[model samples]
Target: MASKMTSGDLDEQFLTCPLCMLHFRDPRVLPCLHTFCRECLQEWATKQQPLECPTCRTQVSLPDQGVDGLKTNFYVNNLLDFVAVKKGAGPGVPCQVCEGGQDGDKSWCVDCAAWMCDLCTTVHRKLPGTKEHEVVPAEVLKAEKDVSKFQRKRHCHKHKNQELVFYCESCNALVCTACTVVDHRPGNDHNPVEVSGIADDKKDKLRQLLSHVDPRLKEMQDALKEFDKETMKLDSSRIESVNQATSYFQHLADLLQKREREILSQIDATYRGIGRTLESQKEAVESGFSRLASARTFCRQAVDYENEMHIVEIGEQAQRTVEGLLLERVNLKPEQDKVQFSERVSVTDFKNDVERLGVVSSTVNVDVSKCRVVTKTPVVGLECTSVLETADEEGQAVAVSREAVSACLTGPKGNTAVPTQLRAKDEGRVWEILYTPEVTGRHRLEVMVKDRDVTGSPFDVVVRSRESAVITIGSEGNEEGQLKKPLDVAIDGDGNVVVLEQVNRRVQVFDAGRGNVLKCFPIDNDGLFGTGTDSNGNLFVTSFGESYGIRKYSQEGELLATFNPEYLRHPLGVAVLQDGRMVAADKQQKSCLLLQPDGSLIREIGKGQLQDPWFIAVDQSRGLMFVTDNRAHKVVVFDLEGNLKFSFGKRGPNRGELNGPTGVTLDPAGNVIVANKADGRVQVFGPDGTYLRTVTTTRGAPHGLALTPDGYVAVACYTGHCVELYRYK
Candidate 1:
């Protein structure tokens, strides 16, 4: 049966079952839209109680009837029928209608799904029931191009003999004419419409879905192309690095080879010179020994056998020869024979240099996650910096060229400003961005590498005017002008100083310039934490002891109102917005609360991120709120909508590091001035959270701080219990 169809006829694998590895038998489609043989799914369902689609691993929810209840894949069934028909059209197929089951002609009964002989085919066509069935010859059926044209009419499952002709829109099912009258009665609950009409409506909806999906598919294809391009670039970079390393080591190897030859030649020349000196000394010693032996022989002969005169003469000659041989200085020791190997240069130093030779690096790209803004807040005339770091996939810092990095600043109304300078540091691993803003407002700074935004790019920068410390307000004492454990301070619209005292529960109103008590108001609350003044110059004090709430007071020491928000526990610092809303930092809750004008809960800011939230300051011009997290030792910035913008400072004693930050306020130029209670110093930062400078280092712990209208900063010292006013403009 397989030999009748060529491999080019169709892909047999598509029609093959993945589980049984054979032709599909009664294919059943799962909810995931994957189809498998009914028996195969039934067998699988037994082993895996909660079955998942084998192809996609999606969990399947089968009908109560199990695998047999799954929807039949009619499309796959039609294709299988088409293939079978094409195969059966060949000769040698057994006849279905003939009694003897003789070999049939190349004719098929589409309705009966069988082959028939010539005589049987004629007899089948004459019968009334079989006459309407499609009895096409194998050659004609094989010539049909479209598989969909071979679709057969389906019958209702309950009514075996009835064809399904109606589609129930309500139930989203197909039904027969009899089913429409019974189970699918034409009503609101069972609207059984003609299949043709409903199918047209479904096809239109499908077309609309396709229109939306096509654009997304195109975008995905483009992204894949981008990935391919990146892969190619990596390949090119690797090849270039390999070439460079090879050339460098090759040059070093050549130099070492040349040095080896020179040293070896020097040793050989020195050895030969020492050899000549030893040879000459050996010859002189041998000659001296031969002369001495000859003289001794003559003296012995004269003494033993020769006449007395000969003996006497030979004795003197022998004596002279012996004496001369001893005095002739014939050296028996080796001369210049030591040719030891001694290093002219230190090998240890050379080895160290070799160890420190060129580093092998991979192609590092700009890592958006590692890039950040160095200067959070920028001044109108001063430069601010944003640092961009490049790294490999493993996050190891690696070099990237300065030319690859670019920075742009956009202010209100989309005014674009370019970076003043781009400088590379840390061997090109870090790029510093410098930009100066021309106006004081909220601006966005975007740092990019290769036209891609770095992580945390497009940072919001609030530029303000530059300010400095000018004066010191009060001294330590309990007198009229003196304060004791002053916890919070605020400046009213009338330029009057309102100081909240922890020891006496006194809210003192003082002259902004002379620091003299104008009107001293006594609060009954024992746990006064912070003081704030609204636009109408009305004072608002945050307190928490027996009862926790914010109290509004008139300038003349009369309590106006009290707001007790349910979520505001342990209110420490409070700031009033121009719209009558209040923001309070709660120490116990470790978060900030935004309250409506009537102290209704608006939202919580930095809920889980903050620890020991102490003070609040609002930058209404940029719609930002700055909170000092004392224990966290950082200032967290949030938008009016409670979205976290950024945070700056860490726990340390350095210039930019904050140690127990408290009493946060904005200077006239919008710079964040935070008092460090632990370090006894007040530090200033740009609007973007970059540490700008220190305002003043107090001898006492500074708590609540506020900016006076006349360019002065009023900081309440908790230990000294006095308000110190500094020049801040």
Candidate 2:
């Protein structure tokens, strides 16, 4: 059997039971070493008691309950079924497991746990091992108690194979034959019956209940189905709402994108404009710095040129190059007096340039094409715009001789309204400005244009010029603060400064700082043309006040008496000599007057030789006096003893010409500053009358020139509307 049966591999190990004849879903090995599927054993042992193994003919005890391991083995059996083949068919037989002759019977003994027909059961009953085993019906071994109550297991109530038979409805239990007859009696209120009848009755009642509930139950289910459909619709609506919100989100995103582009454009434009302005300002600063250095070098040379007068000093040489190198000045086109900042200062690029130039403040980008002004004349009534550009703080060192020019304007209206915008007949367009200033100076012409759409573009107008050397000290205006003629003014030895107004009063003492009225001392009748200072800091004002001579005052409103110098008609200036002597220039007589400190008369400038003598200046060190004459447009030098030394200056607007010349003063440095009125300028001269340069002014009236010991030059800007004091380098 081992060789012919094939020495098989591990796969062919399972066989079907001889009784049930089915492969195992859940295979189990019987105690007799015979195998059976779990469900096959239950069917085979139906109505059997103390069931025995079919293969051994041994009265084997069968398990009352199914084993859990075999039940879970169904999954493993599935794997086996794929590889296994069906077994050979076998002949029908009785139990095939009984040891006695009953095994050959026509019926199986299930309750006795033996395979025997009715004939063999009798013999098996007497067998030693099976005598106590109960007998049961053939092929009906399944007992009521041994039947599976649930899906998992089945078991007998007592012995292994005799399944419980009759069920007692009165006790709600299943019982064997003895229990049925004994426990259940007829009509003693005990109802006992076969389990099949109960099962049939339950089935019939359940069927009736189902028949009654179907339609209504289906109606409720249909209602639930409709509610589910409505819920799905709402879900779709919610999704659509969310999608709409997403659309709005997209819209806002687009708006923000556009806004960002606009803002970036503005930023780029602003920076570009800044770059241009910075370049211009940097040029100005560098030029100024270079000029300053060169000018200082020349000034030093000039100062040292007087080798017989003063000593000089120089700085030490450099040991090494400057580190971290900011603010180093390099010579660019050195011969042309040009230099550059170490780095270009560009707003857009931050790079600086080398040439000197001018930059218009963003506030005052005037339309020069629309403006028409001339020498000695001013332009007004023009509208302009103002946009506050940043200040070039580092570039402020640019030298501007602005306080020495007198500027004023008259218009058809009241005081000109200089607005922040320009609205004009030309539709807010720019006009060309033709400025013909009477003097050479730095001027700013500001104009603004406001359009119909209320939109504006800031445009810049530039007027770049080399600053002139001028030193004007007075201006002209109508007496009631209106337009009128103006005259020379001066700060005398006293702090009391005075000006010749176009008013009837002729001379007004506007406070030097606040421009407030001090006193309008009328002196035209006295033919007064100049004012002076004495050793005591008193104002020895030479006016035609008393007998066409000079008068003296103690600064604190005191009348210190007057002088009627002999041989003097109109005195243009008065001065105090170091030794208490008085000097006066009589322009009407073309001569000088010398007075005793005691109000007595001394000598004269030849008692007759001078011409059109207008102003008197004294060189204290030389003990000499210089006088400017309008008739000759020349200044004649005179010794303290009233003797003419030399003469210079002219009537033209040339280098030394004194056009409408007025006040004059000798600076402590022996330099002479003359207020040239008609020229609308102030000119500087060397001690020997050499034309140095022009002193310019920001305003139109730098008429009276006074320098404190500390170089503070005060100019009484009379009709120009204000008085300003400037510190000179």
Candidate 3:
């Protein structure tokens, strides 16, 4: 059974041509069940190599006679006739063939294309020249279905009473039967065929076209689903990261509140002390004024006595009393109060010790070199290299290898460094970049292709300090003058090496003359880690475990003062300048602190730049410091003011490379000596961070390094059982 068509369906399917979307005129049908106007098909065929159905893109072999050779849709012509009659029946329509009076149309002549009453249509049919003309009853036309497919009359413009019946293949035009003999017959190549012959073949081709479109549509749908899944994952990750950040900042906020209370209490105590002293001074001045008032009253009463003798006797005593009171007032010296309060009091230089406060920052770092890569998965550590492809306006990949790809690295100190090597692979679609970073903390790695950022570009690389030892020192033992798990080393004024061993809590002094033990002393507590010497031959040491402070000692091992500042925690490296200033690197604070000789903190340097600074060496003449950042795999140089001059070395096993570098010092020539604990080698660099040479290639986890006055470098090896001394210039 055929499905019933509504008014809307009839309007779309029958009333208009598929090609021109207008009322059908001379409608022709192809075998594909689609219909177009004769003129539209002829024009469309001329543009195509082989005629094709415009709706389905089906290829068609044209009849030699062109468009007119196709079958005409007669049903469409009848529908058009019905619609015209219906329109003429409306109130405004008038008969075109009427002589004077405007008569409503009752019938339509298909050939003459005239609307007339019953009289006109009858007359038009009876005329000798129009007797064969086709006329339809106006009321009968209203019963027709499929009126949309109705075709309108199209007659030859030049010839009278002739219908266009044939097509000219050579001229690609439609013509009347008379036109064939007059215009088209002159050409023998004008091969004409009936239009009905090729209609079935064209329809079959349209069915084949649908097969190619189905799979491509399915692929697009699948891609959209995958894209939605990835988008959801990205949103979930963003929410999780926000929650973690909130928790971390809450912890910092608590710490800040505690510090705020402590500082306020100090301010209150200062105010109370000054207020009490000022009150006491006010009381002393009031007492002196009362004595003078009593003296004046006594003198006035004596002058009121009745007898002259009485007056004279009382006057002398009164005079003496008043004079004594007046003299006492003159003799009294007022004490000016020296104590005063300042208009405003503040905690200046609060960052003098980093451990006293918390640092807030919003930077997040990820080290690409340490990131793991999954097979057949999107790139994680660095940006995905796929975005380098050329894309269309809709962001779909269109072409590959559209531009040159490049990459650069910027260190934590804002120094931009070009990659040591950058090369493309996989037909210029993939790139490999190599660079060495010099500073610790967050570094930025950027990849660009054609002046555009690659996917997930500008990766944050968190670089850690290197930990390597150059030479080995004393072996582990419990005997006197023997080292056991030594943690720190320092050089004395007399060129003796001071070593602090944590396991046995012993401090051993080794004589540089024969590399023999000179003296051994025991510390009361354990966890001692850092040591240094002042210009006056005073030794300073820092302990981490039970006793957490810096300890000072005389040359003869006599205990001096222990400085336990509230801001010093987990101190690892200590250095003494020629001006009696001390610098200590605090591991917990991740900063280096400068202090006075009395252990009062002056300022902190490299609060965010130094990561786990373990050992330090001072070049007094050059006013510079060399520090080994144990976790960042670099040696950082700084001036006394804590400004970073430069830094060098990266984590690796090769020469001039540092891995777990722990011990650091400077030679007489102002060259840097570093100990790599991971590779057990000593690498030397020039003052400007240029690799000079290697000192010792074999050692076992050297932890502390010290340079003697006589040009010998002593290393304290934690794992190796012996101390090795090398003379380096």
Candidate 4:
């Protein structure tokens, strides 16, 4: 029956399906919290394997049964039922059960989902099937405003007559009593329990999720408002710049008429660029805010109105949605370039140099494409130089003050290093930039002048940590000299390649230049993964499985001590900092632990940021640590205190993409060398996490990698079962 919505009731837009643009029919909610008709979603899902929500276009991982497996929007259903009863389907609604004439007052059958006349209601009561059904007088139901009190008991779609009495915990589905005995019988795959028994716990979990999402919603709202303010500021700045140019040009109107037009045009062009950037940023903020708000509302609705089974079905998707939102870094400040008109002329100067009277300059005037790096490759701890020749709008080099030019070097974990000198030459047109990097890795050199970025402000710079290896080492074998499943590699202070074998359960030391095996020691355990060395020639190894711990050893293969921190589970990679502290990456815990030299836990790093932390490398000189998260497909960098500086990489086969990164090591210059197990490639990045280049693609999957003192990268290949050295300078 059709129902009329009043002004006081829920908005029609909320009840209307996005796909059909009609009142929702069996409304179903997506993980992204957008609602649509079940049939509409089912039809849409048929077009794609991983369904994208028609409203938001979010990728949705549909349940095994597809759209039909989606949980019902009980809140919307209840509202629809309430609105139907309140409006009486537009006066004298005929009894649906009897299909009678519109003559007598009707009573609403909550269970049968129909309207009945008084005579029909009496007959319905007399019928054995409808004896316990709730039949309320239409007038009385219309007066009721509490929608929760009108919640209908859900029934299994397979057995329409039987109510859903059991919730299958394993499959997270609701089933009728008869269906539970057949499909959801007590087994490993299907654990069915009473709906009432699991309700409280599910509700509590959903409530907790709501509480977590509420703060993020507020954050998104605040960020949206901030972007709005920035938009206003951008407009104000644009107007101010135009006015400044107008006022100055008016005084010299007759003498600088043509110049005035050119300057104002430059200002307009810059404003348009900045405006577009600001608008894009604002749109992103608004989108994030809207997504979070909708998801938050859905979480609250599910907890308050949905049945236990429905809650369980949506729990995983909801958790993923919330977790993904939390990981998104909100841009609190506007990043658009500032628009301003600078007067490069005085009255006397303008008269003398009319053609060059007033040059319009901005951060965008540097012409990044025209700028060149004088140094081909920057080596860590060494002086590097890049030349920037400031240009006019036409790309002609023009003179500008040193203060107008700025160069910033950014590294992994968001660490920023500044150039030592920005010497202006060639009549202040050509800038000679000089800087020394302490750590090696992928870094960006952002050159800006007059507050705006050059065309390509942030230039990719890969700082080499070490030169390529001059030799190779190790071969696959079960013998003492042969390597088997070489999972991790480290360079001792004496420049020896220390390899950890996973299957052989041995730490084999080999000479740097040759493949000769120097010494070997049994690990006496399985799941050995990572290895590292300190300046004192001591070695540290991490292992999991049966014997999981961080083991310390001397250069002579003597076990010094073993540390099994109570909280450290599945330690994968280990590194010893200059200060005698230890850092270990725990794959199972999804974090890196900082410990004292004596094996006491100091603190955890990248706690919630890493998904599968496998290996770690450190630049103690700069107080930075780099971690390779295998599952996350990124290298997360953190400061000494565990504060995330930044992270880079993603899942792809492209140049910079990291697919299941396994081993990470830093060169003397802080260049980060990483081995990707999935792709079998070893990539080099600057300290800032910028992918420099792929050193080499191995025939087998690459694991633990290390940079030797003599300028060689020793990579332990698990599948190849060998340590291959590559020259990396």
Best by TM-score: 4
> Model 3, range 91-143, lDDT digits (tens) per residue?
56667777422545476677665677777777887898787777776666566
**Model 4: per-residue lDDT, tens digit, 1-729?**
113333375677767887888999999878787889999998998888677888667799887887787777777887777777766645766777777747778888888667788889899999877787888886687666656656676777887678888888787677889987898889888898888888767667667777777777777677767667766786678778878888888878698999988887867766555555456656766777777778877767667664565666566667678667767655545654565676777876688777765555444334444444443355676676677777654466756666777888877545676556887776677888888877777788887766656666677777764333335566778997788888889888878889999999889889876678889988887788888888798888888887899888888878999998788889888888877789998878788899998888889888789888888888888989988888889999999898999989999999989899988888887888888999888998888888888888887688888887756788898888888887665
Please list the C-alpha lDDT of all candidates, in the order they appear: 0.69, 0.45, 0.60, 0.77
Write down the TM-score of every candidate.
0.36, 0.33, 0.35, 0.47
TM-score of model 4 (CA atoms): 0.47
Q: What count of clashes does model 1 give?
A: 16
What tens digits encode model 2's per-residue C-alpha lDDT throughout 128-148?
755656555433332212111
Give the local distance difference test score of model 1.
0.69
Point out where model 3 deviates above 4 Å: 1-474
How many backbone clashes are present in model 3? Answer: 39
lDDT of 3: 0.60
- What does candidate 1's lDDT look like per residue over 1-729, in tens digits? 012223255577647888899999988766544568999999988888579877545577888998887766665566687787767666565666664444545577766767777788888899876776778776787777555445555667798667777777687677889999999999879998776554434433323333443344344345444434443444344445445444444445654554444444534443333333334444444444444443333233223321222222123333433454445544344421123333333443555454334433222233445555454455566666666767643455755556567788887667666456888887677777777777777888777765567677787777765442223455666666667789998887788888888878778888875566788878898788888888888899988977689999988879999998677779999999998899998888888899988889988888898988999999999999999988888999999888989999999999999999988998767889899999888888998888788867887798988887756678888987677776554
Best by lDDT: 4
By descending TM-score, how would the candidates be arranged? 4, 1, 3, 2
In model 3, state the lDDT of residue 441. 64
User: What's the distance in Å from true for residue 165, model 4?
Assistant: 2.6
